[model samples]
Structures are given as C-alpha cells and as structure tokens.
Target: MDQSYKKIEKLKGEKLIEKLFSEGKSVVAYPLRLVYLKTNFDAPVKIKAGVSVSKRNFKKAVDRNRIKRLMREAYRLNKSNYFNNIPDQYAFMILYIGKTKTDFETVTKKMNTLMDAFLKQQSLPKP
Candidate 1:
C-alpha cells in the first residue's frame, strides 16, 4: 500500500510474460493498449505491470525507453483508480501504439481514461 512502483509490482519471468500476452483481455486508449489477466498467483500485491514500446514505431532504443518510462509513471500514478475496485489479482502489460512520441500530459490523460475504462468493464457481467 506504499503507492509506489516497487520491484514486486513489475512483471517479470519469460513464462509469465508470455502467458499474459497469450491470454489477457485488452483495452486501448489511443497511444496505450493494456493487456490484463486475472490470476490467483500467490503474490503480496493485487497487481503487477509491464510497459512496452514497439521498435517498429520508434527505432531508437532511447525513444522506446523514454516512452516506456512515461507509460510506467502514468500507470503508477493512476493505477489505484481501478486497482482499488478489483478483488482478484491481475497481471498487466501496457503497450505503446502511437506512431510518434507523445507528451507526458497526453499519456497521463490516456492512462487515466484507460484505467477508468477498465473499471467500467469489470462492473459489467461477462457474457
């Protein structure tokens, strides 16, 4: 409950990462796409997150790293918006899809919208 992004909050391990992409449900808000799966893993926290930027869009490693850092910061700040509402544990991967670099303000707004959308989605009964 520190509200900080600690090592435990970061998603890792090749198998776990692969499972998240293969089985997770996704939500998108412009520059950001979130893929998440509910799990029963025995972890200390309720959520784990990973951020990524496609090399196809930003060829430079520095650009990709910058975008990912921005994304992680946004998520870390707004995560509790949806995190507090969910009872189950989850793993998430956030992907950057914009063709060009976006400002922090834009990414922050979109990240809030994305988490809000996720909260709304969870309230609906699955078909």
Candidate 2:
C-alpha cells in the first residue's frame, strides 16, 4: 500500500486558498485553526493540504519546523478517520496559534482531541 501524503496533488495556490476559506467552514482550537472548504466529488479523498506555524510565537526555524512536523504527523495518522464519513471533498488549512513551543506528543494529543471534538460537534457521519 502507498502511505504517501505528497504535497504536489495538494492545493497550494493563493487564489484557491482564499476561495476555500472564503467559502468553507472554520473551527478554531485556540492554537489550532482548521479551515475546511469541502468539495463536490462523489468519492472520498482529500485532494490537498497545508500546515503553518506562527512566527510571532517562536522565531527559531528549528522550533517552527518541529511544530509543523508534529501537526503533519498527527494529521497523517488520523486524517483517514475524518475523511471517510464526509459526504464531500475538502480543501483545508491547519494553523498553529500559540505563544510558546510545545513537544510533539503534546501537540499531537491536542490536535487529535480537537479533531474528535469538532467532528462530534459537526455531527459528521461516523465511520
């Protein structure tokens, strides 16, 4: 099985990003902002994705990279569960908004917790 989460197929254009956010739904988890604009595809598959960490919080490149990596990993492991039940497609962004650096495990736990709570609140179909 291919376990790849490549970026080439993910939407990265500024226009698309703007439109997705403009037309989609948003859920803020304080330090984690999830803006999702679902698509009209008949099948279940996430087309594109992106991650961003706040420079205002941690100015160091290493710290930013670490946080981004943690978020990506959490998404990679748990995204399929979120994608399976949704009726439409999604173009989304995960934004980190915090004042201090965090460990990977802590971030992952928080991300997973936030996702579960959001999905439950949305009443998205369960898998």
Candidate 3:
C-alpha cells in the first residue's frame, strides 16, 4: 500500500468538517481523539483525514504546527495497517488534546493504540 499522504487524501471543505464534528462519533486514546464519519466523497480515496492541535493548549502557532505535523506523520505511517481492509469510505479528524509538547515516538505509540481502538469500535454491532 502507498504510504504517502497526498493532497487528495487530505480532508477539506468547511461544510463537511462541520457535519463531521456535529454528527460523527469519536474514539479517544488519551491525547489523541479521532472523530470519524462514514460518508461518500467525490474523490476516489478510501479515507480523507485531517489533523489538529488546540491553540488553547499550545498558545503559539509554532507549537501547534509542530504538533500537527507530528500527528500527521504518525497517522500517515500507521493508517495503512489499520484501515486497508475497511470497505467503506471515511472522513477523520484527529485532534491533539494534550497540554504539553510531545515526541514522535510517543505520538506514534498513541496513534497505534488509537487506531486499534477505532477498529475495535467499528467492528461492534449497533444496538
């Protein structure tokens, strides 16, 4: 599978983002929270994902940007293993909820845990 995160796979559009947060369900693994929605897209990609870091927590744009970059890299490296078999298209927003700065190893470990939780949640039957 391709490991590159291309522009087409980046989630965009204000309306879609609004709908995702308003209607999507979430899976949390400590500092990382993944809010996801199952939806169709014009693009052919199986998943569209975006990453965010809270301005309130980081205070500086430099800090927030670094965290977002780390989160995105972690997601890019891990997503293929967890999501390759999923049949439905999904939109995902990954938010960094921690207050302090973090390292790449920590981010990658948490990302793996988060993806595992997400897959487990997705496999459960609805009530």
TM, every model: 0.92, 0.80, 0.95
For candidate 1, the lDDT comes to 0.84
Native-vs-model 3 lDDT?
Answer: 0.90
For 8-88, candidate 1 gives per-residue lDDT tens digits of: 889988988889889889999988898988886667788899999999889999999999989988888877555764678
Residue 50, model 3, lDDT: 98
Comparing candidate 1 with candidate 2, which one achieves the higher lDDT?
1
- Candidate 3 local Cα displacement, residue 88, angstroms: 0.1
- Candidate 2 lands at a TM-score of 0.80
Model 2: lDDT equals 0.72
lDDT of 2 by residue, 55-83 (tens): 88889989999889988888777777666
Question: RMSD for each model, in Å, please?
Answer: 3.0, 2.8, 3.0
CA lDDT, every model vs. true structure = 0.84, 0.72, 0.90
Best by TM-score: 3
Candidate 3 deviant stretches above 4 angstroms? 124-127
Task: Give candidate 1 regions above 4 Å deviation.
Answer: 124-127
lDDT string for model 3 (1-127, tens) is: 4788999999999999999999999999989999999999998888999999988888899999999999999999887787777888999999999999999999999998888888888893222
By TM-score rank, best first, the candidates go 3, 1, 2
Instruction: Tell how far residue 121 is off in model 1, in angstroms.
Output: 1.4
Order the numbered candidates by lDDT, best leading: 3, 1, 2
> Largest lDDT belongs to which candidate?
3
